[model samples]
Target chain A: MSYVVGVDAGGTSTRALAVAPDGVVLGTGRSGGANPNSNPPEKAAGHVETAIREALGALEPASANACVIGMAGTAKLTDPQVAALFSAVWERLGLTGVRIVTDPEVAFASATPAPDGTVLVAGTGSIAARIRGRRMVSTAGGYGWLLGDEGSAFWLGREAVRRALDELSGTGRLGELTRSVLAAADVDAADRSLAWRRLITVVNGEAPVRLARFAPLVSAAEDAAPILDRAARLLAELAFAARDPGESTPLVLVGSVLAGPVGARVREKLDGLDVRSSTDGVLGAVRLAGIEAFGEDFATVPGDLPRVP
Target chain B: MSYVVGVDAGGTSTRALAVAPDGVVLGTGRSGGANPNSNPPEKAAGHVETAIREALGALEPASANACVIGMAGTAKLTDPQVAALFSAVWERLGLTGVRIVTDPEVAFASATPAPDGTVLVAGTGSIAARIRGRRMVSTAGGYGWLLGDEGSAFWLGREAVRRALDELSGTGRLGELTRSVLAAADVDAADRSLAWRRLITVVNGEAPVRLARFAPLVSAAEDAAPILDRAARLLAELAFAARDPGESTPLVLVGSVLAGPVGARVREKLDGLDVRSSTDGVLGAVRLAGIEAFGEDFATVPGDLPRVP
Candidate 1:
């Protein structure tokens, strides 16, 4: 009869899962983005509430023993005003003892039962975190699109664009990658200067994060090995930087960029570590809730909760 | 009656120099920042005009045979609206046929008389350009602070902060770099967690480009050699990427990051190449104007011009 709720408040969408003590997913609900960094605090909180309410769905929200939110940019909560807004939402939901952790923590937990490990994420942005138990204790290379985020989708895409620009400017050899990027940017001119100028204009017109949109194209390119090599190396370096010299722990690879060739390359580079992939962040949140509700630090993930891999 | 004008429209300030056909320094002018990327288009244009007006002093602005304005983010002028705004300002200033070039081009021309060469700039942002016939024909690694700008002041500063965070988390060795970065961020907390959290908050509060403010601290740190090594290596790679092997041309180093230890390292990396430092961009502009006015590519830089270096 008792239940716990797990939430994944991401930049693009918010998702919630209601799970029983045994880890059975009772219900699932979704809502708009709930990232405080991207959305207004009130709106972000509202979306979180909406998703949780729908997941609860007459299951008595007050009956839920605990709630854990796996959120992107949880650092926004460091601001008192933003934290208070989120707290008010929890109060209205009739939930207490709510726990919030960074997306990387949930991801690391989702991949393995290990309490301490490393998690490398490479979606729109890239970051690597060292997880201690269920908490992200340290991190490396999460400097965002502006500063670092090397080996991220953003970096991959930016590299692809740079290659295309070089080709258009007579500095790079013409290749299939160059042709595809030029066409994608709708630059038909054979005149390199004109095409180069147009391409720059095209990129600058969009939002900075949208650079990730071109990343998949690199994966599709015939000459993607170089980019993949650099990405994997950088990601591995980040994980290594977050770990002690002799330390050995499970490394959880998460996010879209890592799920493809880049992930394989990272796995190959990190030969000594026990490598795993996070299939679903929601499952990790559910496990955390299980730990909270039953005080089962070593509880095995429920067999019938759907396979993670 | 024939004269030339050269201007450096930078993000912090604008400077202009009037040079007669015989290399006589006629007048000079200074004004606020005129970088379109940093200022409103109108304000950017106004600053440019003010600098030029002051440089003209007693000389008729229309009497100049050629005017060259070197500006940052020249790609922004690819936008028709922004270009039109700048054009209007040029018309009002009676600057007929004002020539605008990328900042790297001016930096290269300032360093050497070679019309074709490579320029490496490592200020808050980093970029390498291949200059052909006094024009920027190709470029590498100018993706701005968001995507790349490797080996720049911003990169050094961001790396220092990252190293500090690692040390605070016990994942890295506590060293001079870590201690310096911690103190610089004003993270006086004995608790590593508190200090880590506070540094993130402080960095996020400022304009991302301002991260360059912490770069100088890294230079002062005892363990700055590795950073300098990496920076110099990356810069050399950028320049090489834009140069054809076996083709020898002057390599010009410019900006604060490259003016110090990093610059020495870069110089050491390119020992066989003709590497020189760009002391004044306005001097480059003056040379370009000379080429335009006299159709002579080989004009000596004026000796009596106020010391630019």
Candidate 2:
């Protein structure tokens, strides 16, 4: 009857899973965002606690032998005050010896049984993590939208706008990508000069990360092949940087940007390597919790839990 | 008694010059920043008026045949209210028929008498403008810090930080550029892992454009040659984009970034073209005003005015 609990605390939402010793998913729970950097510390901790409580609905909390929480802003917990908030959550849930790890580590675990590998996540932002023994040892390009995050959705969207502006500045006929970019920014194109200025104003008017909204347009526009190719190359370089020379371990690609054409290109660029895509990070957390409770071999156990849709 | 007035209304400060029809320096004035985009409309207008009034000295404002104001944010005057603010300044000074032009136009005029050419300005932000008949007809890469501004001081500084983070993530020796960047961020590199995280934190905590503070380090560090070379290439391309194919007009380079190593590299790249440096935009304003009042021949008038120190 013993079980383990796993949680994926992300910027937008939190998900938790309870798995029996034999690998059956006993329960699942969901809650609001729990990333402390984006949410109030107390609220973020409360969300984690709420999700964990729901996942343990009918099960006895004390019977859960191991618990693992994978978090997006794991560095935020380095602050004593923030750490104390999360610790209080664990205490309220009557849980002791709970482990906390970076979201990328759990994502890598979700993709492969390998204990060491590289995980590259390219959502609104991008980062590549070097995982050792199922934990993140180091990371590359997590500098966010302002500094780095090259090859990310933000990068792709920004490139799209830049290309559009270049076309606007020229006398040539506008291409599909440029046309779509202007349309998305709600700019009227009858006046090319005014449109150029308007597009910049519209993009800068919103939060910078919102530029990711235009990423899908780049994938759909055939003329944006260079952008796609460059994105793939930058992403591959990021993944390669997180790995050692000649060390071949599974590379797990996660997040929305990697789930499309960019991901296919990244796979082609990362050819000859064991590349896997992680769809459900909470499942990775479940696997890590299983490993902690039932030993390393538990990672290989088959489970009927489907990927989160 | 007839004289012409010229003003450079910039983001940091305003300068005005009253030049006699004979090209003699009659009077000069300086005041606070007058860029409407960065300063209150009333304040910006008041500064421009103050500078122009001082430059007039004991001369009758009605005797001023022509006045030209080169402004950093000329687009701001597109709004009727903002335009009225500037109009009131001209009206109060009895300055009839004053012309307002973009700062790049004046920069080009300051460097050469050419009516059509390219002007590249790369200070905290970067932009290249196509000058036609002593006016800015088109522009490129003026999307500001968020969307573009490639090869700007902000870009160089951001690239320096990115390189430092990349070296910190790898197992390689830290380069001089990396060391300088880390030091600039006030991050102690005793622990590479912690330093990597701290550098990102420090950068994200401040205004993004503040990254320009590290730009000088890029010029000083020999290891940052690639950054310098890329910056030069980007800036040169920007200038080229603002020109017609095989057009041989003067290309004027202006701003603080162009006054250093990056500027030297840019000049080298723009070889075979008439590349000139613009030190005092107010002088250019004076040249334009002279042209407007005393016919184009006045642009060739010999005078004892020295470049602003």
Candidate 3:
């Protein structure tokens, strides 16, 4: 059986999976911090290699024909500087061949079995993309915490902190969600200023992923407010913009944040739009690599990638 | 000469200027912090009274005619609770009639001597207003630093801090404005993170005006960048929105930041638009009170308030 590898590289962590021709998981691997934007190109590639090695070690005999890495900075993969670094690493690893794409592209491919559709990804960052008749069109937001990332985890997290500070200072008109989120986060009146300031610093400086991690807490407390309504509207706009108005295609929802209430809110906002939540992107990456490496109908094959033992 | 009192109630301090119908400055007063949103109505009113008393004390004998206070919390001035406190304070100080308007209106009047014109004020906060004939239209912003005050000193200061952080972290590819502003502010590499974070925290929290005071430094360092371009565009949009397109009226620029190079940038962006800058809002407040107290044909009389002694 032919083998393939799929990698999802993130800000603080990277997850890699090895799979067979029949779409069955063969092995898994993990590593720390692989975002190229955050580290040197060599260091980023090293992180990916570490993840691949760990995933391969899990298998008795590594059966990997080709590898596809879905990374955060793959949007710049085609750049001469970035491509040279990645190519050097791939060659050093003695891999047969490797394909690279942005993390969102892989997530979109994995979300739907269909070749042509749309995927709305909302995570530490947000982007919407449509794969229409072999061409991809996309819109990205959450460039960082500073600019406009409207409905992003960082945005919500920062808002929660700001609202808490406002409440403590008596300048804010408290809403139920803001109060509860602050309470659940254990921010009190005395330390509210300090905690809120720290949260803002975290959002502006270090890991914005930490803010996305609080998505559940913030979503659980969200009530019917203009702020939430505006977010919902923005999500719907992203979804609709990624979809073809003239053609009918399945709309898939990917990303962890989109798997829960935020997705539910998005779907509610879409109302009549065709959409579904995707289970896994790595699996989709494997299928995509198989189709590109083999043929278009490869996903139809069964028991392709069995767990190696 | 008919007497009038104009108060500029700021976040950290309050200042009152008593003027005569002839536009002659009579007296001036100063007091401490008094924002109704943060302090009780009684406390805020007491602060206002202290400021007024100081100005009244400068006069040989305080002229009693009419009073107009250009205050920060005039939006809530009409509220019964706040109104009652002001009324009690006015009676206690032997001041009879008083009219309250937002600080924006005062700035607008002060910026433009013409009875009908527009003023864009960008201080710690930002707001734009136009007086066409007898009607006034306005847009208020910069309540909190999180949402932003686009063209204000707060925005410029916070942006400087953000760019400095970006440069320190090696994440910025844009311009040198951030680095220059940081160096100008005397924040070094060792203290960069803390200093940057502190600036953002202070701007967002207790004293937004303090950070706003750094806007000129940012303006001095600003070059051609998308961020600065957007800021200029926002000012143009605000200016145009404040006035009717059919009518031709001078657009006055107020606030410390707007009086600098940033205002020139805004003016360039608004090429062909009638815009100019004014030195201070107190002057406009004096002019507006004169027009309201006397007839529209009142000459260029000196402000009536007793001069500071």
Candidate 4:
């Protein structure tokens, strides 16, 4: 009857699942936005707690021995203030063995048990990480949307909007996809030129982060077309950067960016690279916590983990 | 004596020079800040008009045929209302046959009269213009510092601040120049990290446009060693973009950006390119207006252009 809980607190949604020692997802639950930057640390932890409670509630009289949460803004959590706030929340939730780490770590763990691979993550934000001999190295993810965060879903979304505006203003040569995308964004020839500046300002200021949530839609929009070509190119860059020199280590593709058309485009752009979808962040977190709590024995797990929910 | 006037109205100073038909030295006048964006159109124009009158007053009583103003924000005069307001100021000054155009055009015109040439202007802001036939095509200059004016003095200044903040936060890898520059800005190691975010917010919110005026100082400071190497690559990019293929024509460097070390770096970056110094905008404007007014015949004039007062 021993059980465990795992949480993936993403920018737009929080997901939790109850799991048995054998890796079976006993029950699952979801909640609204849970990013620490958007929601306070206490609120973010509460969201994870609520999600876990709901998932465990689905399992009648269910119980969990330990819990681990893979969070998008773990950098913020490293701050003592945020950690203190979350610590209180964890204690209040009656959760005993809980560990929180970056979502990318979970993604890497879920993708494979080996600690020598690379993870290319492009959800709302993008970051590339590689693990070599127990050392974790990362490139470009300073503070998310505001500063650097290049090659992320937000970056692609922002670039798409910028290119669209350039096309509308005749400042940039329009590709087939860009023209239609601008049209879809409600910008036309007559009004496009007149409303160009204002619309561009508004789109550049707001739409990037929001449109990132629709990474799947953008991917779908690009299918059989050339809309997200630039995004695909960026994804290729991230993948190339993640590749190990002269080594055939797995290149794991994680997040919604790899869920649909964008992923297909990324694969096409990647050409001969081998990449696969992440199993699930929560599952990865569970495995990671297990490894930390139980050492090498955690690698002896017998069953396959569940796919991302 | 028939005299033509060229006025360069900047954010900090309003300069006016009266030139004779034979390009002889006449008289010059200066006034305070006359940027229309900062001061009311009439007030800004009044400052320039007063300066022009005073400069002309120093000359013997003679009728001037035409006057040309190479102004920074003329394109912003797109609004009929604003244009009309400025037009009245021009009429009241009894300045007839006046032509107003973007300041960069004047710099390009003054820099070279070779029907096809390019101008890379990096003053308070940055703009690259390619003049071919009768058309002038520009890259990246929407509206001063408010909108998009990348690769300009303001951009560099702002980047310097951001890099300093990044260095303090242990997130950036800036060289010797960054630390010195931040120290000069009164931001040091102890208060550097804490002051960074607030300073950036202040710079982003209010100081960008003003700090842009000090780009020359920043370039000068960087040029004296330590910082020159830091921005050499970026300056090279700007030079290359300005002298891209299909732009084999004569190239000119204009604005305060060309005054100090940045200019030297620019020249080094543009090594073999034909780059010349243009200290006077009014002369450039008048030279351009002369060409436009008289076409091919204008180039035949022998070393008779008016001196920049």
A114-214 per-residue lDDT for model 2 (tens digits): 89999999988999989999988888788899998889999999999999988998889999999999988889988989999999889988999999999
Q: What is the TM-score of chain B alone in each candidate?
A: 0.94, 0.96, 0.76, 0.78
**lDDT digits (tens) for residues A47-78 of candidate 1:** 99998988898898778988889998787898
Give the per-residue lDDT of model 3 (tens digit) for A186-249.
5543554454544443443534456555555566665534445555667667667666575567
Full ranking by lDDT: 2, 1, 3, 4
Per-residue lDDT of B1-309 in model 1, one digit per residue for the tens?
789999999998999998887787888888999899888988988899898998898887788899988998776797799999989988888779799988888888777877899998899988888888878877777766765688899888888887776567664467898788778778874887778767777887787787888888877888878887898899889889888888799888899988888888889989998999997888888888878887764355542356532
Q: Which parts of model 1 have CA positions greater than 4 angstroms off?
A: A1-35, A43-69, A78-96, A114-116, A171-173, A241-249, A270-273, A295-298, A306-309, B1-109, B113-116, B171-174, B291-298, B301-309
Please report how far candidate 2 places residue A107 from its true position, in Å.
Answer: 0.6
DockQ ranking of the models? 2, 1, 4, 3
Chain B TM-score, model 4, reads 0.78
* Cα lDDT tens digits for candidate 2, B1-309: 998988999998999999887778788888999999999989999999999998899999999988989998888999999999888888888889999988998888888877889999999999999998988888888989998889999999999999998898877899999999988888999999889888988999998899999999999998999999999999999998888889899999998899999999999998899999986889888889889888988876523366443
Instruction: Chain A only: list TM-scores of all candidates.
Output: 0.93, 0.96, 0.77, 0.77
DockQ, per model, reads: 0.37, 0.84, 0.05, 0.17
Report the C-alpha lDDT of model 4 over B1-309, residue by residue, as the tens digit: 666777778777888777655555477778876778767877787788787887788554336666777777664578687778778776777766778767767776666666666677766666666666523664433334433345566756655554555465545454454565555565545654455644544544544365564354456454334344444455456545545564567777776655667677777867777777665676665665455554555543413555544
Look at candidate 3 and tell me the lDDT of residue B284: 53
Task: Highest lDDT: give the candidate number.
Answer: 2
At residue A172, candidate 4 shows an lDDT of: 51
TM-score of candidate 2 chain A against the true chain A: 0.96
Q: Quantify all predictions' global Cα lDDT against the true fold.
A: 0.82, 0.90, 0.63, 0.63
